[model samples]
Structure formats: structure tokens, C-alpha cells
Target: MHDDRFQLPADADERTLLTCFLDWHRKALVRTCAGLPDEQLRRRAVPTSNLTLLGLVRHLAGVERWYFQGGIAENYPGSLYTATGKLGEDFDDLDSATGEASFAIWRAEVETSRRITAERPLEALSTHVITGQSLSLRWVLNHMIDEYARHNGHADLIREAIDGQVGE
Candidate 1:
């Protein structure tokens, strides 16, 4: 908790620091999604956008899958949701029953990503799908830290709009 290097300790090694961010991001993600009503989860804060808290949950799950499963493992389990831009389309209004499923998928992706990261060496190189270029596991993990942190910020705004909830 005392660490300040992007949620990590200044004394920690590069790998450990990156791991800290990864851990922070996963926890932050869950916190952002917690305790929201179905109606609020589906409500779009922006007047001209399709983004909603529930959709963000699904989107981040997909983001984890595509990055770790598809890009890292080279075998993604397909997508749980498509690129739909309709409000309330994500998880069919984020009701309690369906919210459980959404949480399940998000939880699964977190576990999968953790396993992948732990099993692979930090210096190990893998092919990047979008660029067809190679990058070390270290690089991707660092990038994911950035990715999750950015999305969590977006999530903060959306969650705040839902009921004025704020902070982790």
C-alpha cells in the first residue's frame, strides 16, 4: 500500500512492480463494477454514446480474453459478446441473475490471465497479432497494466454517474 510507482513499490524489481499494477488493476476492475443496480448499469451517461457500466464490464472481459487468451496463448475462447453499440444490449440490462454470469466471465478471464502470466517467463517473447511483431511477456504485461488503468478511469466516471459513487 505504500508503493507509489504506479501502484507498486519503488524498491521492487521491474517484474514485481508490473505485477503490482496488474494486481491493482484486477481489484480496481471488480470494485468499479460492484453494487450497481441493473437499470443504472445499463444507462448511458453520455448523450451520444453506447457505453454503459455493464457494457464496460463485458468489454473489459473481452479485452482480457483477447489480450491474454488470444494474443498470449494464441487461442482465445471466442467472444462472449459482440461489438454491439446498443444501450442495455450488454448483459440484457445487467440484472442480478445475468449480472452473475457477467461476473463469472470477468472472473474467469482474470484467472486465465493470471495463469498465463505466471506460467510464461517475463523475458519470453510472443507474437503480437495486430502488428505481427514480437514482444516479450514483460512488454505485454506492462501494456495491460496501462490498458486496465485507463479503462478503470473510464469505469470510475460511469460508476460515479450511476449513483455518485467514487473511489476504490
Candidate 2:
């Protein structure tokens, strides 16, 4: 409910608005994980779900890599958390994964994503390796906004479950 500095502005252009929203969503997830102990941060806070703050952090890090480096840049630097032929590895092993490492990777990936996008125009296209489909930076930004928005909602519930603290 409290308005933070990360909130997207209503008057911005398409590019500015999209980037701000994505950033707001990113910070929302991080805010949810802030101040919690490593154990609680990594706990499966949702019922019948493998979702955890730490895992979300790792998952987002991989997402950053997949979208920016793998998808946009087409660099294929490899996944951050999941190994080859593995699935959901980011959201797995919550008990042993530490928040510090996860945050470090997540933050770094975000920085890289920002750089990649800043250097390109919204109409710039990138190919998807699996589907051989071309996608524009516009599409990537929209997708990232939606992706982080959904995940941040889950993070909100989990954080509320862990502690009484709650906000956008």
C-alpha cells in the first residue's frame, strides 16, 4: 500500500513506462525478501508449491540470463542455476540454497539485462534458439513486466505468510 520510489510513472512514454514497471516489479520481489533470515527466506512458504524467495531470486536470475543474454543478445552464456537437462532447478533445493548467493546472481543479472536493453532500441529483434522465432525488445520488456508482476504477487503472499510485513 505504501508507494515506493520504484513505482512506475503514469506520464512516461512507452519505453520508460515499460522499464519502470519491470524495475518496480523486480524491486517488489527483493523488498519482500529483505531482512528475512536465510532459512525463512528459502522456505517453501506457499502450500503445495516450491516457491520461495531465495528460489525466486535464483529463478529470476536465470530468467535475466535467458531473456537478455540467451534470447536478446543470443550469447548463450548458459543457465545460472539449472544444469543441462534439468528443470526447475532454480526453484529446487531450497533448504541448502543461500539467499546471499542468490541475491548476488540476481542483482548481477538485472544489471546485465539493463545494459543489454539500454544499448538497443525497442524494435531491435532477437531470435529464440529453440523456436527460431524473432522477438523484439518491446516484446521482451512487456514479457518481463508480466513475468515479474506475477512472481512478485506470489512473493507478496509468501512474505506475508512468513512475517506480518506486507506492501506493493
Candidate 3:
């Protein structure tokens, strides 16, 4: 498949590195679902797991809103997919999931996240969404990188299971 992710610079400032790495992981996740039909993207390829590419996209959309918009910006609208305020709904409630809509929401949230990050300095702080403790933009960026990295691993396995494709 053709990968269009940004390349990590050998040397850069902290902010550049963090944002670029996060973006890299984000693109990697999308790469995992590339060229698959909506049905294939929504298939729980793993026999015993509920995970799907569409579900991952949905989950990350909520996560992008939760951390950047809610945790950092403090707007705190609420969950994107979960209506009853329950967790994992983004992944579990996917009977009607569509690749077009899921990807659109995800891309919009990611763009919002990028805008929020650009407006704040690395040291800027906001109240944590769950704990109400203070959190820095740096921490949120790092955490998001880790979050996407972990989920990208899951996406890789799911993609491989679906079509025998591999490599990030």
C-alpha cells in the first residue's frame, strides 16, 4: 500500500517531535484500514475479540475529543458515541457503523485536536477530565501518542487477519 505519513525528523524541537510522532501514529492507524471495504473494516477479524478498524476509528474520535477538547480545552462536550455515558460504546455499538461517517468524524476531531495543540504552549495546563487534576499539553500529547501507538498495534493485527497484510 502507499503510505503518506510524515517522516520523523532526525533533529527537531520537542513540540515538533511530539506532534509529528503523534501524527505518524495517526496515519499508521489509517494505513491499516486502507483499501478495505466497509464490511471488511468493520469485521472483528480476530476470532475472540470485538475490535474492528471502524471501531478503532470511532474510539479514537472519542478519545481525541475527550483528551484535547475536554481535558485540555475544558469544553468537555461529552462522549462522541456513547449516549448513556458508558465506556467502550464506541467499540461495542457498531451495528450501523459506516466507514465514511466514522472516518469523517475522526478526521474532524483530529483537526480540532491539532488546532487546540497549536494554540497552546507545551507547558500550558488544563484540568484533567476524570481526576480534575492539572495536566500539561505536553503530557496530553505524549499520552495520545502512546494511545495511538497501542491501538495501531491492534489495527495492524486486525488488518493482517483480514487480508494478510502487514508492516506499518
Candidate 4:
């Protein structure tokens, strides 16, 4: 497999390090779903959790939009997945989800996020979606890293259970 997460430099600045780690985790989610069919991608391996690789992709796309566009960029074009007021629709509507479309949406959102934050200072603040409070870019980056890491852990288990494929 072609891994993009291993290209991190040993001596890098804080933003570089954080963004590299975020990119690594981003690709980790993609890496975990590689070669799997759409049906397999939508499989909820864990009986207790409704999370699927496809769902994660859709969820993350919405999250990327929520934080970057809605929160940080203040674009507020509404959520990509939860626009119907159906919370958790990303995971709930997996039977009709297509892996290719989900991945494309996610990739586009990630690109948009990068563009939005690239020139912004870490201390620059944006209003929160729910709280109407100021949120710094630093907090957003940290939260995104944490979100991806947490979901990627679930993805690891799901992928392994799907075909026994495993790695960081």
C-alpha cells in the first residue's frame, strides 16, 4: 500500500507537526478502508457501534464543514450530512451511502479546511456554532486531531474485523 503518513520531518515547527499529524490521521482513515467494497465499507462490524468506514467518511466531511466552514471560516452553509435535521444521519443512512462519493466529499472538505487555515494565525478566533463563543484556531486544530484519532481507533477495529488487516 502507498502510505503518506510516514513522511513527517524530525525537526518541524508546531503548525507543521500538528498539521502533519492531522494529515496522518486523515490518511489513516482512508488507508483503513482501502480495497474494501462499498458494502464492506458500510459494514458495522461492532455490534455495539453503528460506525462504518463509509459513515466515518461522511461524518468527518460534515465535521470538517462544521468546524472549518461553520466554526472557523464562519461560512455556515449548513451541514453536509445533517442538513435534514436528522442528527447522526451519516451513520444511520449507510445502506444508501456510496463510498466513492463519501470519500470525494471528505477530500474536498479537507482541502477547504487546509485553505481556510493555511494563512490564519493559531490564536485567531472564530465563533462557535452552538455556543456563540470565540474559538481559536489552535483549539480547532487540537479538536480535529483528537476527533480523527478517536474515530481512527474505531476504524482500526472495524477494518481488522472485516479482513484482519491491521497496522498504524
Candidate 5:
């Protein structure tokens, strides 16, 4: 009920608005998981789904690295998870997942992403790791906002199922 996300400004530059909205959504995802037990955080509340709050964190950690570090910075080492040719490992492998470590990795990756964004202008371009096509920082930022917005919705539902907690 007490939100700690960045308050979006009524008037701001494009970069500020994009980054602020992205950060707000990023915090919203973490807020969805706050104060929950590790086991509860890993619960697949949805029937026939592997989606979990911890998995979403893990997935977003990799996503941050993939988009900002890899796509924009062009220095992708590899996935934070899914290295064993096991796709969806981030969401499926939660047998031993811990909230502390997962959140830490997610935060670290997000910090790196902020740094990457700070170094470039909106018009700055980089190649997409998959499509091998050029993209601007602005595009990447918008994509990240979309990515987090979609996943945050999932997190909210999963959290609600876990403990009946719900909010923006």
C-alpha cells in the first residue's frame, strides 16, 4: 500500500520520462514480491504455469543484461541463467532458488543497465543481438518499459494468489 517507486514528473525530457517510468515499473516488480517468504515467492500459483515471482526476477535480471548490456552496449557475455541449453530455466528451475541471491543479481544487473543508459544519448545506436539490426537507446528503453510492465502484471497476480496481497 506504500509505494516507494520514483514519482513521474508532469513535465520532463524524453530520457527522464522513459527512465523514470522504467524505474518505477522495476521497483513495482520488486514491491510485488516484498515481505514474502522464499518458498512462497517460488510458488507457481497459476495452474499449468511455471510463472513465479522469483522466476520473474531471475528472468528480468537476464533481460536487463541482454537488452542494455548486450543489445545496447554490445558486450553481452551470455545469459545470467539458461546456460545449459535449458530454455525457461529461469522460470522452471526454482527448486533451490533463494530470494536474497535472485534479488541481488537483479539489482546488480539493473544498476549496470542504468550506467549503460547514462552513457548514451537517446539517438545512440547499437545492434540487436538476435536480429542483427540497428536500434537506438530510445527503442531499447521503450522495449524495457514494455517488458517490465507485462511481467509486473504477472507478478501481481502470482503474489495475489500466494497471499491475497494486491496493489499498483
Candidate 6:
């Protein structure tokens, strides 16, 4: 039996490895809402702002885009505002015009980031646009993995409350 995971090396540096893990988990996170009831997708299951599961999915998509495409991949050419100039408030929009616009922005970012990862080797380092520091492909990959894992935990509680589905 074999277990397949995204981490490149068993003894790899935490930042590098976690980036891949985060990417996988984020993928899983987005998939969490797949095929769910539209009303449920639009409903906020928790007490936070208006973060519906669908909203989270869109939000993460936006985040990945901004991070990979905007920051690392594109280096933030234009503006990076998801919601009223607040990045985290992205999910708070809850399918509003801002949400819809951000969703499109996020989707574009994800697609561009995916292309970047596919084309570039993980060993190659990408410079953070604002920081002017080089970040290895491996590093960002792990970062994304960790980010998704954390949020998915939040999603777990929300989804379970909405539909009794949990884990992963």
C-alpha cells in the first residue's frame, strides 16, 4: 500500500514541505463545498461575518490568486483589494458584487499560479514583490498547505453544523 502526498521530501524543510501540504489541503478545502446545497453554500453556518462555505471557497481562491499570482507570480502589478481594501474581509462579502468580483479575480489568480507552478521548478526561488526577498517555490507551496489546513478546520465546524459532514 502506498500513501500519496504532495510534500517533496520526507526530511525537507518545514516551510518548503508545508507549502505543498497547504496547497493540497487548500484544494481539498475548495472541494469541501462542491455539490453542496446552493442555499447551504450561500448560508453562513457560523457566527463570524457572512462567510458561507461557498464564500470561503471563493475567498481562498482569491487568496491563492493574490498570493501566488499577484504577489509571487505577478508581483502585484495593479491593486490587491478583495473587499473594501481588506484582504480578509473577502469572505465577508457573502456573494455580493464584491464577492462576485473577487471570485473572478481569485479564480484568475489561481489559474495563473497553477501555470507558474507547473512551469517552474520548486527549487527556483520567487521574490516577494513588496518584501524584495527571495522565496523558494517549495516555501510558498508549504505556506499555502498550512494556510488551507488551518482554515479547513474552521470550515469543518461550519460544514458539520450545516450538513453533519465532518473530517478532512
lDDT of each: 0.74, 0.83, 0.88, 0.86, 0.89, 0.64
TM-score, prediction 5:
0.92
Total clashes in model 2, counting residue pairs 3 or more apart in sequence or in different chains: 0
**Distance from true position, residue 128, model 6, in Å?**
2.7
Taking all chains together, each candidate's TM-score versus the true structure is 0.81, 0.90, 0.91, 0.90, 0.92, 0.70
Best by TM-score: 5
| Residue-by-residue lDDT tens digits, candidate 2, 1-168 | 555434556666888887877887888887788899998887777678888878888998888888888888878688777776467778886777788888988899999999999999999998976557788999999999888988888888888888867645
Q: Which lDDT tens digits does candidate 1 get at residues 1-168? A: 333446455587877777777878877877777887667767777767777777777877877887777777777676667647553354443445355677788888889988998889898777756546676778778888888888788888888887888548
Q: Which residue pairs overlap in candidate 4's backbone?
A: none
What does candidate 3's lDDT look like per residue over 88-133, in tens digits?
6788867778898999999999999999999999999999667697
User: Which is the winner by lDDT between candidate 2 and candidate 5?
Assistant: 5
Clashes of each: 0, 0, 0, 0, 0, 11
Provide the lDDT at 164 for model 6. Answer: 89
Check candidate 3 and list the clashing pairs.
none
Off by over 4 Å in 5: 1-9, 84-86, 129-131
Let me know the TM-score candidate 3 reaches against the reference structure: 0.91
* Candidate 4 lDDT tens digits, 1-168: 654545666677778877888888898898888999999999989888888888889999988888888888877777787757766787887777888989999999999999988969888899966658788888989999999999998888889999998635
Compute the lDDT for candidate 6. 0.64
Residue 158 lDDT in model 5? 93
Superior by TM-score: candidate 2 or candidate 3: 3
Worst 10 residues of 4 by lDDT: 1-10
Please report the candidate that would top lDDT against the real structure: 5
**C-alpha RMSD in Å of predicted model 1 compared with the true structure:** 3.6
What is candidate 5's lDDT per residue for 1-168, written digit by digit as tens? Answer: 554333555667899888888998998997889899899988998779989999999999999998998899988878888968687888977889899999999999999999999999999999977658788999999999999999999998998898899646
